[model samples]
Target: MTSLTDLSKLDDILALDLPAPDAGAIEAARARQNDLTKPPGSLGRLEDLAAFMAGWQGTDRPTIDRAQALVFAGNHGVCAQGVNPFPQAVTALMVANFEAGGAAINQLARTAGADMTVVPLDLDQPTADFTTGPAMTGAECLDAFLKGAQAVDSTANIVILGEMGIGNSTVSAALAHAICGGTAEDWVGRGTGSDEDGRARKADVVARGVEQHGHLSPLEILAALGGREQAAICGAVVAARLARIPVLLDGYICTAAVAPLHGANPAFLDHCLIGHQSAEPGHARLCGAMEKQPILHLGMALGEGTGAALALGVLRGALACHNDMATFAEAGIG
Candidate 1:
């Protein structure tokens, strides 16, 4: 429950120069990988991914000991229009589940050696249903975004963003449609296992919202259709990059939040690592729009930072291999 005023605002962070992935660190990692005991290219993409991490961290040695996973939760008024299969109560309940460390993400973070935070952003007052009007005011959207920025742990080199809201997927698609310039029908998908009929109904909701406000700027698009959690995640992405932390992105709703940031600054993608591809229909298109490939394709749509937490282990292994593998000369093998 960090306040928006507690952290540096997204406006301030975006005003500063963002660091790109370091070329020197990347080359150094590649050289060391070639010198490792394994035959050149034997470890496959691990060598490449590890090198990317080095470049991201601006060092030949990249570590994620203080990885931070924040689950931003809130209610969407759009849920009242039958867009969600679940009740709005689930949003508040899940925040409690996160706080108790009883949710799947809690267990996953414990195993990943990452700290977890459940951020309840503006759940006290739900956004207006965008089918009729804007979800929130521009000021509110900026506040939610700043609160998201505040949630990040400065000590964390790896940041994971996820969200929980019943009808958020509908708003996510709406936001994406506005920012990415796609039809609402193309971006909307079933959330919480909505049936075919429910999907169409949800799609119509987004279409109506987008028809009214699709051409607005990033913050305007967010104010028009974005949910509280989505706004926060968007701000978090900007803040993480300001601190030069590599991001581990979750699925559809999360990426939908990401669309505006990508639209505003394509360089933001260079700092993101897609944790997994979601079963949500529009997610692949979202990733495709960013020209990013996910590390896992397990067809997961359960968003609570579950995918990112799972991916942390793989990152840790990559770091281990990069630092511990014996060189060919050291082992007298070449």
Candidate 2:
């Protein structure tokens, strides 16, 4: 919360009580909205989500003008399991693209006026192929969380979480099944354009992981089933909530990463906004588990925080409308 330096243990970080949204600010925002010239509730969920942002900041005027995207990049060893179409090195290549401002997320974030930062993690060699063995050691998973938590910068009040790693969806489905309660078939999906045969194989891989290692503690489950970037995204969610920043959850892999943390602390969901529902099957399950509705769908499955980055523009518009709409008294209409 405090610049993420001098961090405590991972459990200690998650155990800390996050700052609560200000009820008084929320009430005030709602009151002002009633006086606006537009019909009550006409603006609908856009109005609602904006109010949540106001309460999240405990302010009469909430703005996401300075939103930032936290994109975690890493490689998964299970990529060798034939889960993805691209080679795993594309993870590093995409990171370079992000750095070079060449990826879709870069253009989307720029278009939405949000800054982007990439956090890199190394677990490719250490993490076992969960289809055959554990994805990571418990200590490594804890360390990944610590690093992810530490990735938060002081510049932005709203953070959008995204990830890059070949075969991450396989890990995501595995973690979703292990944590959210579902069959591997229910959780697996076509990532990066996998064919029917590929989807079936992915389901089998996830099922094998769950069968061999299931019902561990949330952290252990993460280490056993999730990738390094996924672990970091989980920690980043906790840190964002502690800092009272509205976290924008990206597609399947990103949302899957947050499930464990939300499982540990229900209050953490207060600060999260499902950026959008990813096209991936497991994304819907994650949203169902969280009781969240995706603000925008658009059939997006690209997972560089692209959906979340684009949604920042919508949030900006929502806040602008909330703050700038004329009241009946001001407009002399009532």
Candidate 3:
């Protein structure tokens, strides 16, 4: 089947319409967070939490009734450098597994009690599911980027983005370097277990790809070096923001995928909730460029929302504390 490929058409799709967060609502949520059970500032991230929910639902009491995890899987051309152990073909294989509900991400989404959608984006593959469709053109990439936000298919206010591509870190590094205006040496990392030699080789490949295609626009950079997973996650970021849902970003490849969207629309940040910082050197640089403070910093290199999954509990706890915790006045402790 033909996938979404027109950049402009994708743009139309990504131009999703949604409600904006109410300034009054967010301010009220912020106040509630400050007055939560523990002493003020006791729940560091919880502070960010209450506010995030407020902004997400446009209510002082934001409820995470529904959450989604979008796992985008694809292959990378630059993986030929042996930066990753898995072959490029593994991307298509994993996409099939994701469709079959047999991948790590699938299991984690279940564990997290969130709905999961797998889009077999036409990467080097031939076909995929309807929920997540074909490879994106410049416009298609834009569409894919917007898919996450649109996937909610409702007024839900929480979402998490993940990836399942093989050799995607290579693509991530290339995309990062291109958009961040940094050298490959500054953004390449060992993805899915790359050795030193592999890291060096990956960097060299990205440097060359950058020199060859770096001058292109950010979207073009994504289309050129971008994998199917990157495209879909980008779409997810767009959809999440447009819908006023907070997106919990995953590790290197996943986070890198959102770079173009964030650059294209600064307002996107309003709906983002970073899961954690990874040991991946390039990810730190990307995070820096985004000016985000990750929720966890466990030096995690695993992708597929493993970090996000591990960190989801923290968000939940923060939410619980923000909403259920007894105020100091209620406890009469102070």
Whole-model lDDT per candidate: 0.83, 0.83, 0.71
Best to worst by lDDT, what's the order?
1, 2, 3
Error of 2 at 325 (Å): 1.2
Task: Kindly list the per-residue Cα lDDT of model 2 for residues 204-228, writing each as its tens digit.
Answer: 9989889888867776788888888
Residue 301 error, candidate 1, Å: 0.7
What is the per-residue lDDT of model 3 for residues 66-109, given as tens digits with 9 covering 90 to 100?
77777776665455455677766777777777788887777777
Sort all candidates by TM-score, best to worst: 2, 1, 3
Could you tell me how far off, in angstroms, the CA of residue 20 lies in candidate 3 after the best superposition?
4.6
TM-score to true structure, per model: 0.94, 0.95, 0.86
lDDT of 2 at 221: 80
| TM-score for candidate 1, residues paired by index | 0.94
Whole-structure CA lDDT of model 1: 0.83
